[model samples]
Target: MTDDSSRAFVPGHVTGFFSVHEADDPEQAGSRGAGLTLSEGVTVEVEPAVETSMQLNDEPAAIEAVTRVLGDLGVEARVTATTDLPIGAGFGVSGAAALGTALAANRTFDCGRSENELVTIAHTAEVEAGTGLGDVVAQARGGVPIRLDPGAPEYGRMDGVPARSRVEYLTLGERSTEEVLAGNTDRLSEVGVDMLVRLVEKPTLPTLLASSRKFAREADLLTPGVEDVLEDVADEGGEAAMAMLGETIFALGNGLTRAGYDAEACEVHPTGATLEMD
Candidate 1:
């Protein structure tokens, strides 16, 4: 009924992603020029408290965003979780956190917002935070996401990479989402929007992802190493592409085999994030 309600929840997560159509430079990505859905299967925990106190890193913006959404719903709860990843590494960390909080807080108050509604709220928070152009949508709706228009911020679900595809990911490092978004507005344009629309309508999901990856490389967002890695993987009988921003890259194609990639090279993750009540 209110923030005082005693309940909790945790949700699942996956690293779904929305592709970027052009090159992102320092002037655009602010040092972290790509976007992605970070760690998936994130676990969120909630507990009933006299008042709502969200415990997380210094993401007051996220706290504020969730609080505002919860306030609108007249529900509240104690929110806490693992040290959240950077805001923008192209991972849906922001959406995961928001959705996790919403799921947790929903139980705390016995509120009944549907998953769709919660996702909508999370998207609003992401917009308010300005960490992503469409990470919320991809995170919320999983799978390969294709945003036809960055202006209206509209997108739709895309099929996963083909089952027979051979690919793996490589982690580069970490970067803050906020820092990456700091100077990216100039790169956002109608042309990028059109490119996304075309990709989404591609005959196959794999084709769509491959094309988008090429576009990213042509735009110069994909570093030499990143491009080299992709080329190596693809030439080695696999297709490799940047995952989210730069923190990681995933290889895709018919010839890729799990054995082809070094398990020790990078951590494998479920495709989405999750939350739960303890």
Candidate 2:
């Protein structure tokens, strides 16, 4: 008989971040971003096995993270993961999957790794794969998390907004985070840092939405589809902003749905990933 462990985590929408790298200290290299965790998320199931195998909703990039953690523990397992959100649309699906997998596999194999260690593994995998930057850490500590300092949990700092509200989003299409990050991000990082500072000084839902939109414009990340949704949201007297690293438009209210966009509505997830055994 084999015991299975399952873990689920909410997806986050990064408003902005300043990506930094410390080659000598991988743990100190990451982004400082602010975003909220949505109710939609990824779930991973793991059980002991003779050899490691993974099924990740056809997400190839996630395999490395799972395999790396399992290999480090010298624990073979069969891992399966699923998610409700679209990948590469800035919903942080990859980060959620990686974090959830780490948590589930750890418990499934009775590995005594601490939470911070698991988070570091997942964060490093995301960074190396270019799938995400600070999503893993933010997802580890849910709500409207502000990655005040860069890097994995062990070497990073985080804060968040306590007020929760309904969040609505529309998936426009996919954008490759790797491609975007590879480009010159001087202006983007500068604007992101400014926005982060402003938001931290006054952490509120309205401030987050406003700063997110400001970041999009300053970073030149808005696409035609995203612009259209934002316009529609505005006409309806609501605010909307593009999710970082993707083409999705996340609104603060249900205005997008009323404006004829198929917006998915969910509350802000107030906590991090969770694991259960059966």
Candidate 3:
């Protein structure tokens, strides 16, 4: 028998997803922003962690997603993680965990699925989990992601997205994704969706981010100290914005370093997941 077992750490993302564009129109979530990584990837390893207990609301969805991958690869495994950030906090925890599980399963079973393939699996898991939309794409291809249209799942990866940008996140306790969204129907606007469509189609994220940030403010999702922090980042010569659900805010700018912001006051995490090979 083959020794199939590996570990992968999927990073967490910020809030800011209104809706996925439907067949007839664009989708958007203007009242949110996601930021910072907590140095903890959604770690998934091989070796069948056995009868693990998951504390998430959608245990069935998460379990089913992992089980399907295991069945496809003919392997066994166990998984666990913290459920600190509630769903709809604008943090891409669900997507990150699903991505981590997929990668970990592949490594554990030697399934040989590509990055894109893993993204597809993660996306399916998100839909099943009912956490949010476009999470798979956000977790897989991060850094100011702009998905212009919906239904087709076509996204553009903008190079130099962080060329003149720096992102920071603040953990303002915890909030429910559903509650935030319930209170944030006004943030999603038609013009913003159209602009997102244009930006994604042309693949201009940095420029479009400026407008996106503005729309976020109009939607009343910006958290306390967010505008102040953004101003500080702007003073240092960069563009700043709040992320998914006001859970965190990121400041993007040219020559912006970690020193420019108060990292001690916030949770800082890199963009992306990690891999653990046994």
**Distance (Å) between predicted and true CA of 67, model 2?**
2.6
**lDDT (tens digit, per residue) of candidate 3 on 83-160:** 445444456776676677777777765678887666666665555434555655655554544444332133323221
lDDT of 1 by residue, 65-169 (tens): 556556656765566655434334444555566666666666666678776666566656655555444554455544443443332122333333322222344
lDDT of 3 at 151: 23
Q: Give the alpha carbon lDDT tens digit for every residue of 1-278 in model 2.
A: 24355555445545544444435565677888688888778877777777778876754344566676677677787777787788778888777777887888777777889999989988887777667788889888888898889898867889898788888888878898889888888888888889888899999888888888888887887788788888888888897788888888887768788788877888788888777546
In candidate 3, position 59 carries an lDDT of 55
What TM-score does candidate 2 reach?
0.92
Model 2 residue 16 CA deviation (Å) reads 4.8
- The local distance difference test score of each candidate is 0.47, 0.78, 0.51
Superposition-based RMSD of candidate 2 using all C-alpha atoms, in angstroms? 2.2
Model 2 has a clash total of 0
Question: Which candidate achieves the best TM-score against the true structure?
Answer: 2
